[model samples]
Target: MKDIILRLNKLFESRIRLGIMSILVVNDWVDFKYLKETLDLTDGNLASHLHSLEKNNYIHVRKGFIGRKPNTSFSVTDVGRKEFKLHLNALERLIKNI
Candidate 1:
């Protein structure tokens, strides 16, 4: 129970980060504005979380140009996808036990 709780807690913690991660998992690529709007986060707040995920190698950012305008997209890497799934499963197991 403790182990299951720990895993659930890890994912439950860092709400902003988990939100960003969950969003990235669903889309192949997502823009900053989409994330900001979806999460209803301020610019600075969203940026900070995105940076943390990038640093942790849980997410990747691609900066490029769209019609000569600068664009940034975020996506979760394979490692991140796997981790998210594991955490979700941990929660499921915990729920099942109870």
Candidate 2:
């Protein structure tokens, strides 16, 4: 229905963003290098998508050091989980209606 379509979050419209969230949803924390490798994205491309999610408060970031190297990781927030669920439900509803 129209209401279900309207419930979908535009923030997840991008495939890259959707992929990022999908990984984060299952894992408690995912490192930048691992995500880049898994998603097959360049540094700039991944960073931009991450920035969008972070700006929306859908994901949280942690920066630290792994021995002598700097490490960055990401995790989904509670709000992000809720919104992602709603978006998925909207998609399901749309499919069922069709």
Candidate 3:
């Protein structure tokens, strides 16, 4: 149990981050507005969390323009996918142990 707990990724400890990763893992590309609406997070709040993940190289951010409007999208990287899977496995182990 202790070993399994240690396998949990600290980056995913926050619900906000976990939610972000969850959405990114399944989607190819997700726009800022879509994530904000789905997660119901304020701009600043979401930005801060997104920044954290980006800094860690867990996600990739793309900035572009769509019909004269600036668009920002996110996707999970290979490293992120592997790490998140390990974290989820740890969580599953912990639950089953309990």
**Winner by lDDT:** 3
- What is the TM-score of each predicted model, taking all chains together? 0.85, 0.96, 0.97
Off by over 4 Å in 3: none
Tens-digit per-residue lDDT, 1-98, candidate 2 = 77887898999889999999999999999999999999999999999999999999999999999999999999999999999999999988989998
- Least lDDT summed over 10 consecutive residues: which range in candidate 3? 1-10
Record all residue pairs in model 3 with backbone atoms less than 3 Å apart, i.e. clashing. none
Residues 1-78 of candidate 1: C-alpha lDDT, one tens digit per residue: 888877773543688888888889889999998999999999999998899778777888999898998889999999
TM-score of 2: 0.96
The lDDT of each candidate is: 0.86, 0.95, 0.96
- The reply for model 2, stretches above 4 Å from the true place, is none
Model 2 alpha-carbon miss at residue 78, Å:
0.3
Misplaced by over 4 Å in model 1 are 9-12
